[model samples]
Target: MSHFPMDIIESLRSISRQTGLPIWLVGGTVRDWLLGRPAKDIDLIVPERAFEVGQHIADQLNGTYIPLFETVETARIVLRESKMIIDISNFRQKMLEADLFARDLTINAMALPLNGPFEPAQLIDPTNGHADLSRRQIRAVSKAALQADPVRILRAIRFTAMLGFHLEPQTQQWIAAEANRLIYPAMERITEEFFIILQHDKAHQYVDVMDKLGLVRVLLPECDRLRNIEQNNYHHTDVWAHTRLALAELEAILLSIDDLFPTHGEAVRHVLKQPMASTRCISDMLKFTMLLHDVGKATTQSKDADGIIHFYQHEKVGAHQSRAITKRFRLSNTETKFVQNVIRSHLRPLGLLAERDHLSRRAYHRYFRDTEKDGVVILLHALADISATRGKSNWQTRRQNLIDLIRQMLDYYYQPQPNPPLLNGTDLINAGVPPGAEIGRLLRQLAEEYAAGTITSREEALAFVKQAISPDATTTPHSDI
Candidate 1:
């Protein structure tokens, strides 16, 4: 009642009163309301004739009606230009139980009346959702619900991460049995949930559950390979443990940086604090990249004679695997390329350093060309990835190098593109220079030299080009010529 937007409540009540149909603001909106969190989207339950009610609400509010399952009984109401969603559903006493039962956990099943009398909106304790919510326990409504939709198994992990709740024992068993069914869900759906976990502060807790329930094997079977995969002497944990720790550290780093720079976290932290959510700022494609970033280690891991393990050419191998995975997931071209770029250029820390022998100007250009604005993400991933390695590598030195590289790149990227061809080919042609391959090459060379501060004026550029075309004149000084 506290967190529910008064306007949404009044709108629902107006609809229910006008239609003579009972509607209740149920599900997450109510749960979040009780938790003192902001609830903008609405999910309403109608005892009977939900489709008619849905059509009426959309009409009355001038909203859009979207049939969720191509069924008139289940529809969504979208407020015009507001991005507010009101899911309307027909109440099937058994199916309502089934729907509530099918939800990943019990705490999300509580409901409140929309247009009924002044009495308190009934808690509707059919599944003991209130008790579970009070206990902060995520208990499944029924096993049949998990059978109906196996994706709920994966979603349970997300709820645990977001709410800091523990999965009930029986629900935990259900998840263990059906975790592999996650592969049956759409890749996009799996990736959607992945980000929610990454954004949450307690993301590692749910990831641990995912690992234990065998869901990691189904969604990212590559993770299973990392289990018991020991690292070299410098490491403190195995690959799977390291991966989860890395992700958790990434979240912490993002959080700490936000405290240091609030506006930076504005886009990412919103979904992190939500009970049920998806990523908004980081694209779904990038989430996939994060999910698969370490996958190649499963293939490239090796043990040397000295008992030291090395993942040789992991980045190169990862790049190939990422492309295949992207295609298998039916990703868009831009998304596929983005994932590929992340995987390929993930090992960019040393290259970002100012070491003259290691980093050429051409290499510097290539880094910007590939990473573009995602340089931040790449750098973040590098920091997280290396830290996860559990090696003796000095993070401070690495961090300083990264900071220097970022400052340099930002300085270059933000400035105007080197004064926009101070001497164009037209200028070259007008300077008694014949139009030919030499002219194009000479003009390009002159612009590069001018950009590097070798020449300042058009006269200097013209004089330089003349000297190039007449090197013989260096020996014979002809003032007239």
Candidate 2:
């Protein structure tokens, strides 16, 4: 067996001797240790009264006790000093053999004796889990195991991607046969598993495998609808295919972001690593956005008189659709807004690039302002989207142009503001402007003009406002304007 900290070993021995209960190190912890991976969490199985044992362990180690599930006599002890979690649970059945047999996968069914010497000879493998581990394959213990809990279907995919393992043929067939059983689990559980899958570096590969097994259709019907929705010649594949490729490209960009743009690498990494909501990182959220970026194309697909396909306002429609999806998954309000805003503005970078020469300072300010702190994220998504397509002429030049645009946005974001506001709402109210919505509109206009470099001083802003409110003014003072 692999060496563990002396303190952990001694603690386990003390707990086993004090309680006089049979405790065994079980499941993923043992599996990970045998594979030479650091085990952050330890799982211990007892014949009965697992909660009492968990409480004893918590008191012994002065760790925080978390009651995970009362029904199954399961609890968790978080050892802050070691940064390790000890999960205690009762056997699923009366016997240890039955409990091990009931596990989801063979590689996770092995256990080690915790009360005695921690050695490989002490392992209790009711199934050939060690051999399966040696072969780097995920084999289901039995079909009944998965039938008991369909969430293992997703877990299988996660392990395949994370550990670089392949599913056994029987296991794959069982997954396909029982894929629909996923609906029986709580949406939160499903969402958590899906989020974990997205956290992997090569999530797209496993996601494609999930799609082939019909899991995507059962989980996200919105994305399934994009499978055959054809796009214009600008795209080499259909909507769903392009979306998948974009997701893969997103991973590639993140992996090589530092090498691709050394100047803004730190800023890019910081933005992607920030937490959004429910402990989900911004990078995982971006992967979800990329998958659903073109979902609106399915509904808004139309052919003009000359047979030219058009998805006009798809981004706007996609934003609304993405909001509904996020709500269904019970994401926090902050997360919902982040996903919706990014989807809505996914096309803005390219739109700005089309008018690169005429992109005023005010336009730059508005782009970053509307995208919020996700301006860099939106630009990366746009880059992945463009890289996935084939029909764009001067593709190399366009890619370079996008890189240049990202640098400009990053400079604007990280560096000091070029034009500070010369007037605020208070300033406007004090300048004979009424305290109402009009003040806000006029202040925003002044700020825009200031960003455009047309007005530099408070007196110039006052003069510009004066010209706008005058009867001889040709332009109207609208909120958006």
CA lDDT of each prediction against the hidden true structure: 0.68, 0.85
Residue-wise C-alpha lDDT for candidate 1, range 1-481, written one tens digit per residue: 5545778678778877886777777788777876767876888887667777888889888799887753437889898966688898876464555556556567777677766652334666568887787799888877877777776776777887778888899889988887767767677777666666755655666777778888778766666777787777656788778778777666656656565334445533443333322233443344446667777788888988987789888877878887777676565676666677777778775455536335433444456655765665676666666656556666656555565564454444344664666678787777767888978777756755554455777778778877776647453322210
* Poorly placed runs, candidate 2 (over 4 Å): 1-6, 17-20, 65-70, 418-420, 466-481
By lDDT, the best candidate is 2
Q: Please report the TM-score between candidate 1 and the true structure.
A: 0.78
Give the 10-residue window scoring lowest on summed lDDT in candidate 2.
472-481
Q: Alpha carbon lDDT of residue 143, candidate 2?
A: 90
Candidates in order, TM-scores: namely 0.78, 0.92
Worst 10 residues of 1 by lDDT: 271-280
Question: Alpha-carbon error at 442 in model 2, in Å?
Answer: 2.1
Number of the predicted model whose TM-score against the real structure is largest: 2
Estimate, for each residue in 224-278, the C-alpha lDDT of model 2 and write its tens digit: 9998888998888999999999999999999988987788798789889998876
- Clashing residue pairs, backbone N/CA/C < 3 A, model 2: none
